[model samples]
Target chain A: MAWDLSSDRPIFIQIIERIQMDIVSGKYNAGEKLPSVRELAAEAAVNPNTMQKALSELERTGLVYTQRTSGRYITEDEAMIAGLREKLAREKVTEFLESMKRLNYQPDEIVPMITEREETQ
Target chain B: MTSLLECRNLTKRYENKTALSDINLDLTAGHIVGLLGPNGSGKTTLIKLINGLLYPTEGSVRVKGHEIGVESKRVVSYLPDHMFLNDNRKIKYILSYFSDFFEDFDSAKAYEMLGRLGIDSEAKLRTLSKGTKEKVHLILAMSRRAELYVLDEPIAGVDPAARDYILNTILTGYNEQATILISTHLITDIENILDEVIFLQHGQIRLHATVDEIRQREGKSVDTLFREVFRC
Candidate 1:
């Protein structure tokens, strides 16, 4: 997948978000072996050190684990992935709601607008 | 374990003009530093001083704790802004030439990159396009396992796609212990890979900070900050 990095935020944070999205979306399945830091950095067109930092942060959150010799792997906990998916969805929805509110749409109008947009699509 | 590069009271002068004045900087190992500035900002002068091509008028530059000389030259791989290779030579010949001159040059890696880029080893350099020639130059320079890689305008003339390839090549080629000091005005193109940046204005050091710090504090890219700081 293409990495769309903005200049406004720290790149390592973006790396974390991208990897988290991949894990939650099942692009990287639970218990599957993740690519090496160098491989991921090259793919993302970022520094390996930055990628390593991101992976370490993921490990801290229990989303990834490292084996001393073999390398890093995605967490085998299915519930953690589900939780992350829900969290990401909620954050996106909150953002959408805020934007709709700014557009002067009432909370009661949002559900109908969503259904109307989905049907038109 | 001295700093990878250190400059003390570094100043450069030619005749009556001062190119760089009273500069002090230290670059440690493992950093990909961006030496950024506009035209005649002494970016080239600083690079030339580090490469030992031009001596400083009143100061010193040390690489791995040694002054810029034979010892430092051995460890510093420099890619000057201008074309340094002979156009009459073929790609293979240039590879051999690099291998002969630089003890750290890895012929195998150079050949691998050439093949990956679909550059014929037997083709003469004169026949290649401008961008291809620059790629060849980059391949040769990065093939060296030097302690410090000083690149001047490595991405200047290339298209966006080629720029990405060039940046990736630099990123993957260097060893972890080595440091890369890339001097360029194309701040956005190189900003993502940079660990730190040193901005120069009017032959003086303007700012030096890590990329993350700048992004966090300024809420913008290096490109935007540079434009704001140096706006005419």
Candidate 2:
């Protein structure tokens, strides 16, 4: 998939978000080796330094870790991955709710609407 | 930690006008720096000074602690704003010339890039399309193992696919110990691939900061900030 980065936010932060989504969604398995910074940069069409910055931020959050001589890998902490999934899902749900509220949908109307769509599908 | 390029109060003046004024800048190794400005904003002058193609009216530019001289020229792989080479020759001929000229030129790499672009080695530069010529220049410049790569508007008027190719070539040509200085007004296309951006306005440095820093502090991309700063 194309790296869908918007211009108004920090590019590296977007990179971080993309990588995290990949990890939590099982696109990258736990303990899997991540691509080198250069490769990642090319894949994202971004500078390596920006990729480096994002990888470092991921490291700080304990989602990714470096192995020095070997390179970086996705964290083996499955709980951390699950936790991040929850956080991201909540953010998306909140966004959906806000947009629905803007459209004059009551808070009580969203779940049944979702279920009705689910049944129709 | 090594300073790849440094300028101290670097100024260039024409007969009655200043093109670049009192510019002090330092760039260390391992950066893709964007030199951005409007027309007549001295981006070209600053690049020329770095490559020793033009002399400064005052102040100095230093590359790896040496002044702009033969040593600096040897390490700075420059692609001028216009075609500097004679376009009457074949791709292979210029490839050989570059190999024989620059000590760091990688002929194999150049050939690979040309082949990837489906550009025939036997084709004359004059016979190629404008986009192909630009790609050839970018391939040749990037094929060098130089200390600095100074590309002046490499993607100014290219098509979208060509732009992607150029940026991908640049990204894959990563060198942790060398710096790439690219000058262009096309900010949105390149802002993602740049480490730092230097904004020049009215012949002076208006801002110099990392790309993410600009995004964090200003809450917008470099291109948006540039539009706000240099808007008519």
Candidate 3:
């Protein structure tokens, strides 16, 4: 799928977040070879330099690593991926809670509503 | 490390009206810079000055440390605002003409792109529709392995679907070391591909900053900012 990037934030940051989500969700498995920067950029409809920047940032975060000759790949560290998965889940929870609070829902009433929706489904 | 393009005190005046005034800018290698402005806002004038099509009134434009001359022209692949090719010639003839004219023009690449568009090489330019003609010209311009690509309104005339094709071609087929300078009013369509953007207004530069920097500092997209800044 094409990258649905928002314009208000930094595009590279969005790239990083998208890749992180993809990695944690197993779209890109651990130790899987990542596509070349040019390919990813073209798919995202972004500049190659910006894609390169996002990939380099991912390297820094230990989600992806470059092998010099063979090119970049997803990190093999399961612990890091698990940690990122938890972090993303928690961020989603925070967002959900904020939206509920804005709708005048009580903080203590959120968990029951979440459980009831899950049960109904 | 040297600037790919440098403009110093560049000003252009057409008799009674000043088009560009006292512009000092230097663009480094490898970045996609957008030259943006509304109608009659000196974007075209700046591009014309860079291409040596029109002489600047006050100052100069240098490419890779030399004045705009044969060497600079050799390195700057320019796509003017309008069609420059003779429509009577066959596409195959033009392909050979480009190969003969420019040392760096890639005949194979141009043909490959034309083939992708299903454009018949034996057909004359006059037979193609306006959109196809624009794409064909873009293919010709992009086929050159030049150091700096100066595209003036490359995406303006075409339809939305053609716009996507043009942007994809631009994003995919570019040399890493070569810088691209795109002048267009379609900000939202191109914001993601730009490293830096220069906003021109009333014959002057209103802003020149990285896309991320502008978004971070302004808390809005470049399109929104442009609308706000140039609002009537």
Candidate 4:
């Protein structure tokens, strides 16, 4: 759910990312019940309405589903999970590569060293 | 769900000047809303109206689906910008008085919070520093599990560190069933925590929206937009 980051970024985007991370990290399993809006808001130290906005967005992306009386739950679709993981991994790789470029280290310089460290381990 | 609080075309005017005008708003349960405005912008007057301390010159305010009166007062716990507690009373005694009046008052929660703030229950309000006095007032406001919590500038008198503590206390102590309305000019600090923000200027609501909507529509931080709109 959303958190009061007090940062320049809009909180709803961060909320979407947080729920995605929870799914990828296995903190919530497919078809499992998600926390109620009020409960998640309290845990995140945010307003309940803000938390609701985030959950509604997750539902739009097919990552979560809502039942009339039963509340929200994680989507059971395996493809949704795969998409989330792929998106996150791509973001991490882009950030890592950008950092390397700034440091003036090419792939040849960085990858060989990483492989060497891996072999030593 | 029905609105827990609503102000319909609310207007408040002094002999020659308007304090608030044509205001219409609604507040539901389980939201922490930011009530923001500059000095003399009627933030204090709005809080007073909501608390039934001041009467609206025109229109009406409903608390929990009824007009602001004795019944409405029972459901609302208000912390005014200025001190309301008797200066001569001990902090502990004042808290006890609050507990006696408000059915939802939690004395244990008040004590636990004061202990965290290093406040001595035995100390009289007159003996404490200004900052500590404000802290005590804040602790009282939040200790209640009221349906609606109306706090006016809860951190204005405290230092930055203490302000952070005050914000944290509000965040942690709130019950899921209650709605908190905080009125202050400190927009940047509270902007992140708000579900919706109502911006007042010249005693009128200029903007009201969810934080996400503001960022999406304006393409700027609330602080940045505030400066542009209200800048000298």
Clashing pairs in 3: none
Q: What would the per-residue lDDT of candidate 4 be over residues A12-116, giving only the tens digit for each residue?
A: 787788889989999999999998876676677565667788899999989999998999999999788988899899999999999999999998899998899
Model 1, span B70-112: residue lDDT tens: 9999999899999988899999999999999999999999998
TM-scores vs. true structure, each candidate: 0.95, 0.97, 0.97, 0.82
The 10-residue segment of model 3 chain B with minimum total lDDT is B161-170
* Cα lDDT, model 3, residue A8: 94
Find the 10 residues in a row with the least total lDDT in model 1 chain B: B165-174
After superposition, candidate 3 runs with Cα above 4 Å error: none
Which regions of candidate 2 deviate over 4 angstroms?
none
- What digit string (tens of lDDT, one per residue) describes model 2 on residues A1-121? 2377998888999999999999988999999999999999999999898999999999998999999899999999999999999999999999999999999999788889999999999
Candidate 3: fnat, from 0 to 1?
Answer: 0.85
Ten consecutive residues with minimal summed lDDT in candidate 4 chain B? Answer: B164-173
Question: What pairs collide in candidate 1?
Answer: none
For all predictions, the C-alpha RMSD in Å is: 1.7, 1.3, 1.2, 4.0
Q: Work out candidate 4's RMSD over C-alphas.
A: 4.0
Q: Scored by CA lDDT, what does every candidate get? A: 0.90, 0.91, 0.91, 0.86
Top-down DockQ ranking:
2, 3, 1, 4
What is the per-residue lDDT of model 4 for residues B1-232, given as tens digits with 9 covering 90 to 100?
8899999999999998999999999999888888887789899999999988899999999998888888988889899888878999999899999999989899999999999889999999999999899999989988888889999998878887777667767766687678889988787777777878889999999998877778878877788788888888
Better of 2 and 4 by lDDT: 2
lDDT of candidate 3? 0.91
Q: Kindly list the per-residue Cα lDDT of model 2 for residues B1-232, writing each as its tens digit.
A: 6688999999999998999999999999889999998898999999999988899999999999999899998899999888766799999999999999998999988988888778899999999888888888888899999989999999876788768877888888746788999999889888898999999998999999999899999999899999999999
When summed lDDT is taken over every stretch of 10 residues in candidate 4 chain A, the lowest stretch is: A1-10
In angstroms, the error of model 1 at B166 is 1.9
